[model samples]
Target: MLFPYLLKVSLLLGVLTLGYRWMVQFETYSKFNRLLLWLNVLAAWSLPLIPLPNWGPTRIQAEFHQSIPKIAQAAPAVKHKIAAYNPAPTVVSHQRLSSLNQKLKSLHVMQWLLVVYISGVLVLASHFFYQVGGLVWVLLRSPKEKSDRRVVFVRNLRSNSPYSFFQWIIVNPEKHQPGELQHIIAHETEHALQWHSLDLLLAELQRIVLWFNPFAWFHQKLVQANLEYLADRAVLDGGFERKQYQYSLLNAILCTTEVPLTTSFAQSLLKNRIKMMNKKPSHYLAWGKYALLLAVLYVSSAFVAPYTLTLVKLPPSILRPALKTLATNDKVNFKEVSSKILSLGPSKAESLIEELKKKTPETTKAIQPSRSKWVIKKNDALFWVISPLATLDDINEIRNEVKSFDAELNINSIEYDPLQSFIARITVHVNVKSGSSSTAKEGTDRYSPMKGESGYLTKSGSLGTGSVPNELEKQLQMDYEKALALSKKNEPYYFETRLMEKITALGSSSSHAFDKNTLNGAAAESAFRYDGVGKSTDNFLKLEPEHRNSELYLNSKPATFTELNSLSFDLVRSIKIIRDARGKKYMIVYTN
Candidate 1:
C-alpha cells in the first residue's frame, strides 16, 4: 500500500512537471518561476497527505453494496440460513481463509522490498554525507577571507573550486585571469548571499529518497538551471562585463565537477542561462500565473483524491485457490453471533459494534471536520461485521449482548441466511485528526504505515455523516455522487478490497495483498528495484516491486505486472532480464 501511496506522489511530480514545462518553463520571470518550481515539488509531496475539503466529494461506496450481481453456481455458504443454524460446528469461510493466507505470504515479499528500498536510501544518503563532509574538511584546512558577511575559502584546485555552499564561497584564484576571477567571485557570491545552496540540498534529498523516479532527477536539473540563470543575471546587473562573464563560463566548464549540493560558477546549464539572460524580462503581470497555477492544483488535488467513506463490505471474488470444506447448509447458531463477546475480556470489540450501529442511516451524520451536510435518516436496519475467527461461544455472547442493549438493533440490517457469518463485524470509523492517501481529514495518517497502505483502520462504519435532514440528504447525495464518479477514474486500485470483504460475488479475482505487519514507517512500497530478495516456486516467481507501470515478457510474450499477480508463482520456472544490441533490457519470465 505504501507503494501505491508513493506511486501517487511520483505521479504528481510527473503531472506537475508537465504542467510547468507547458506553462512556465520558458518564462523569463526568475523569481516567480523559482517559486513555481518550489510549489510544484511541495504540492506533489504534500497533496496526497491533505484531507479533502468539505465541499469536495463524499461518495460512500456501499461497503456492502452489491457491486457485482450474484455469480453463477453460487457457493453453499452464500445460502446458509440463520434460523435453522446448528451451533458447536465449524462454518469456515473459504474466502476469509484464502484472503488471510494471501496476506501471510505477501508479507514476506513486502519485507524483501523494504530491504531493497532501504539499501538504495542508505547508499545515496552515505554518498551525500560524504560530499558534505568533504566540503567541511576542505573549509577547515584552507585559508579563508571575509568579504562583508560571506566567508571565501581559497583552495588550490585546478578546476571546479569556484562554488558556493550556504555562506561559504570557495575559489581557486590561481586558475582564473583577474577579470574572470572578478566574474567568478561575483557569481558565486550571488549563490552564497542568496542561500541557493539550501535549494540544492533540498533537491538532492528528494532525489535520494526517490532515486528511481526519473522526474525527481529532472526536477533537480530544473532547479539548478534556474539558480544559474539568476546568478548570471546578478553578475551582469553588478556591472560585470557580460562578454567576459560568458567567456569565463565557457572556460570554467572545462574543469567543472558535478557537485549536487553546491552552486558552481560554471554549469551544464550554460546554454539555458545565456539564453535566459538575453530573453526579455517576463511582464511583472506574469506573476499572476503562479496564482492561477496554485488554484488549479488545489482544485484538482482536492477533487482528484478519493473520499474516504466507510461502508460494510463483502468479498466479491476468489482470485486464487480457496480452502476446500466451505460452510455449506450448516444452521448458523444465532446465539453465538451477536454484538458482544465479553469472554475475550475487555476488548475493542464492543466499541466496534457500537460504531457500526451508529453509522447506520438513522444515526449517521455529516462527516465532521468535513462537518458537511451528509446525513442518512430513519434507516433502522441490521448491520453487523462478524470476525471470521470468532468461535460459536463468541457468537452466543454477542447475541445475548445485542438483545440486552436494544432488542431491535438487528431488525433490518441482518439478513437471515447471513446469520451464520463467521465474522459478525460492526466496525466504527472514528474520524480522528489523522490524514491519509484516501479522502477525508480524519484518521489514516499519511506517515503511519501500520494503518495499511490505504491508512484505513477500524473502518466499515461511517462516522457522523448520517441522514442529512430532509431534502439535504437528497441534494448532498446527488452532488457527492457526481464527485465520486470522477474520483473512481483516478483513485488507486487498492487490491485489498477483495480481502476486506467476506460476502464475495462469484468468480472474483484479486491482486497480491499484504498484511499490515510488513508495511512499516521506514519501509514498504517502492523498495523493490531490479530484483530484490524474493520467493520463486517451480512455476512462477513472486516478484516484489512488480506492477511498477512497466512491461515484462511472460514466455516471450508481453505481460503486465497486474496480470502476473494472479499467476501462481509456483508455476514460474525462471525470470530472466535480457538485452539486445540496443541495450534495452527485457524481462522474460518462463512458466513451468
Candidate 2:
C-alpha cells in the first residue's frame, strides 16, 4: 500500500515541480500562480502524512523516501546529457538498444504492483467523497414551497433543511424585516441560477480524494470565497447603494443563521470580500501561463529519477513445494542436497534428483536403488535406470549406496491393513530397461533355456553349449555380464527375505489366495534385482512359499514364461531377428 501511494504522490509531485519551474522561467508568474505553486507543494508533501487504505501513514512516508530520493542530483546530470547529445551515425543501433534497456528497467513488477495499490486507494477516496457529500445534502434540506424563481431566506438562526441542491427560500420568520427577505431571496436565487450546487459537489469530491493535499483544500476554500464575492457584487449591480448594501451584508451576517445549503453569508469574512469588490479586476494571461505550466510539468515529470526494483523468479516445479515448506515451517532449507550435488559436479541428472528430494522427501526415500540409478515418476510413467557397477560392494547393497535417490520416485498408492499390521499391496509402476531396447530382450532371453517361455518361469533352459553358435554365445555372455553387473550394484537382495516373511504370514491365514493372475502380475513387475553371482536380473518371481509339496522356498519366473523349452527357444531366436528394429522386448530369466 505504501509503495503504491508513494508512486502516485511522486508522479504528481514530479509533474507539478517541473510545471512550477517552467512557469517561473517563462516570466508568467503572478500571485495566483504563486498561490497554486504553494498549494501543490503542500499537497504533495502532505500525501505521505495521509493514511493509505492498506498501509499506515508512517509506512507510506517511509516508502515515499525510499522510492524517490529527496535531493535529485541525478536529474541535473541527466538533463545535461540530454542537452549535450551528439548523434553518432555509426551507433544508432546502440542508442536504440540503450533506450529499450531503459524502458524495460522502468516497467518493473513492483511498479505494476504500486499501480494496482493506488488504483484501489483512488476508488476508496471516491466513495468517501460521495458519502460525505450525501450527508451534507441530507442536512441542508428546507421545507419550502416549490417555485420557478430561486429564493434565499436570511434568518437569525440556521434551519435543518435537506434541500442543498435546489433553490429554496427559508427565513427566520421571527427576525425577518420587511425588505430583508427580498434581499436574501435575490442572493439565494442568483446561486441557483448559476448552478452553484454542481460546482460545490465537484469541489467537495476533489477535496476528499486529495484530502492530504493542503493546497487542494485551500483551492476549494478559494473557489467558495470567490463565488460568495461574486454573489455580493451582483446585489450591488442591482441598483443598491454601496453603503446600504454593505450595511445589509453586515446586518444579514448578524441576523441570518447559517443554513446547510446556503454558503455562509456572514460578516466573518465580509471585510475581505468588500475590499476585493472595491478593487479593480486584475487580468490573467491564462493561455501563456497555462501552456508554460503544462510544458514544465511534462518535462519535469519525464526527467525525475526512475526507480529500479529487482525480482527473482523460481521455476514452477520448485515454487509450490518451496512455498508450502516455507509457510509451514517458517524456513525452507535444501542446502544439504544442493551442496552435495554441487560438490559432485553439476549434472542434469543430479540436479533433478536433488530438486525432487527438496519437494517430496517421503517419495524420494522409497526410490533409492544406487548412486547411479534415478527413479523418476512423472504422470503415469515410472522409470528407473540401473547403471553399471563401479565397485564389488555395490552388488546386493541397497542401503545408502546412491545418495538416496528415492526423492525422484513417485509413490502412486499405498494400501495398508492395520488389522493384520501388513501392507496388502504396494502398486508401484516402474520402467526397467537394461542397456537399450535392442540389448534388453537379448539379455533377458539369455536365461530362457532354463524354464522355456511359460510367462511364469525365471530362467531359460540351456541349449547344449556345443550346439549353440559361437558368435551368438559370445554376444549373449557379454550382454549377460553387463546386465548382471548393473543388478549387482542396485539390487536389494535382503528385500526378498522381508517379502517372503510377509508372504508366509498372508498364506498361513488362508484368507490370502495364491491365484495365477496375482502371481503372473507380480512376476511381470520389474524391480532392481540381483543374482547370487554379482549380476543384475530382470526376471520376476512366482513364489509358492507354502507350496504344500514343493521343496524349493520360491519359484522364479521370466517375463515370458509360458512356452516349452523348444518353442521358447524358437521364439527367442525369432525375437533376435528384428530386435533392433522396433517394439518392446522382454527378458526371460530363470534361476534355480
Candidate 3:
C-alpha cells in the first residue's frame, strides 16, 4: 500500500520540480510567487496521501457481471436427451486458475518487498533525527547575549559565517566591526522573524522520507535558495544600502555548517543571490506560467491520479451457494397408510401430519383422509406415508425424519437394508417430440462411457472426452516427457561396493594422503577445502565423508549404492582418480 503511494508522490514531485525549474529560468518572480511555487510543490508531494472515493459501476464492472454465471438462467433444453445419468462435475478453465495462482505469488513477493522498503525508511529517519539533535545541542550550549525580545546574539560559536536558527543569531564578533556586524545581525534577524526555520524543517523531513527520489533533493535545494532570496530582500527593505550590502556579500567567506535548517549569511551560489537582488521585477504577464501548473494538475487528476474511485457491486456467482431447491408443484398431499403395521392412534397421526405441514408447507399442503397405496401391518409402530411431494424440501424433510426420528413417517425413497440404494436417481420431464427427423435410435444406452463424433452423447453412450480440453492434454504430455527425461539423467550410476570404499578412502586430496605434490594451480588452491565440491559448483567431486555436492554425478548420473552394478574388489584391475584440464575430477574403475 505504501509502495503505490510512494510511487505516485515521487512522480508528482518530479513533475512539479521540472515545472519550477523551467519557469524560474524565464522570470524574476517576487517572494510571494516563490512561496506559492513552494506550497504547490509540497501539495504535489502530498496528493497521494488524500483518500479517493470509490468509483463504482465502471465498464470493468459490466465485464465482471458478464463473466459470472446466473443460476436463474437455466441451461437450454437439449433436442435429443437421455435420462437416468449422473451429472458431471463443472470444469474450471485453466486461465482462471492460472490467474489466481499468479495473484497469490505476487502477494507474497509484495509482502517481502514491503518489509525491505520500510527498514530503509526507518534507517533514513534515524539519521535525520541525529542531525536535528546535533543542531539542538549547539543551540543550547553556545555563549549568547540578548539582541532583542524576539532575537538572541550568539558569540564564540564555531560557525564563522553568521547564520540564524529559529530565535538565535550566531556570529563571530571578532571578524567584523560594529557597523558590519549590525548589518549581519539584521540579515539573520529577517530569517528568524519570518519563521523560515519551519519551512526548512519540513523540507528536511521530506528528504528523510523520500531519500531515494532525486527530485526530493532538488526540491530541498530550491526551497532553501528561495528562503535565502526572501531574507536578502527583507534586509534591503530594512534600509541597508544596496552597494554596501552587495560589497559585504562579495567579501563574506562561508564556514559551512552541518545543520541545513539554519539560514547561512554567506552561502555558496553568491552570484545567483546578487543577480536576484539587482534583477528587475517580472512582468505582470509572467503570472501566466501558473496557468500551466493548473493544466498539469487537471491532467494528473483525470488520468494519472483519480480522486473519485467507484466500487462496483456485482451479484454473487451461482457457485457461491448450494443449488437452490426448485418447486415442482404448488401443493402436495401426504396420506397415512392402513393402520395395521404402524397404528399411531388417530390423534397422534393427525398431530404428526399437522407438524409436517407446519414445518414444510411447500412440500406438505394437506394430509389425505383416505387410505394410501402403502399398507402397514397391524400393531407395528412404523409404516409408510406415501407422499406426493418430490421437491428438494420433501427430500430434506424425509432425511431429517430418518436421522432425528422426528415422527413415525416412512417414504418409498428410503431403503430398509444396507446397499439397497447406493445411487440416487432423479426424474425430470422433457418433451422429445421434434418436428424434424432425429438421428437417435430407439433402445440405445446413450451413456455407455464412450466418446461420440456428433458432439452429443449417442445411443452407443459416447460424449467425446467429456470436458477435458485438447490443448491442456498436449501441454501436460509435453511437460511429463521433459520431467521423465530429467529424472533419468539427474540420477547417478554408482560403482560397486569395493570401488566405492576405495574412492571414499582416496578422499578429495589424494596428493596429501600420498605426500606427493601432484596437486597444482587451481587444484592446489582448493586442496584444503574438501567440503562443498559437488554442492556449490556443479560437475565436481566431494570424496570427503561429511561434505557432498548435490550436482556431483557418478559417471554423469546421480546414483544410490543400490543402483551400482555388482562387482568384486579382485575383479577391479585398476583404480584411478584424475583431475582433467578443466579441473573436473573423475573416478574410474576398470575391470581385468
Among these predicted structures, which one has the highest lDDT?
1
TM-score of each: 0.49, 0.31, 0.43
Q: What order do you get sorting by TM-score, best first?
A: 1, 3, 2
**How displaced is residue 123 in candidate 2, in Å?**
15
Off by over 4 Å in 2: 1-142, 150-164, 255-262, 283-592
Better of 1 and 2 by lDDT: 1
Compared to the true structure, candidate 1 yields what TM-score? 0.49
Candidate 1 C-alpha lDDT tens digits along 99-215: 987877778777878778889989999999999998888778887778775556556464454788888877878877888888888888888888888888888998898887899
Off by over 4 Å in 1: 55-107, 158-161, 284-292, 303-306, 310-592
Model 3, residue 203: distance off in Å is 0.6
Candidate 2 residue lDDT tens string, 449-558: 11100000001110000111122234435544654554343232223333345545544311112223322345324311211111113332322222222212112322
Candidate 1 lDDT (Cα, 0 to 1)? 0.53
The ten-residue window of minimal lDDT in model 1 covers 315-324
- What is the C-alpha local distance difference test score of candidate 3? 0.48
What's the true lDDT of residue 492 in model 2? 28
True-vs-predicted CA distance for residue 210, candidate 1, Å: 1.3
Residue 87 of model 3, lDDT score: 82
Candidate 1, 510: how far from true, in Å? 62
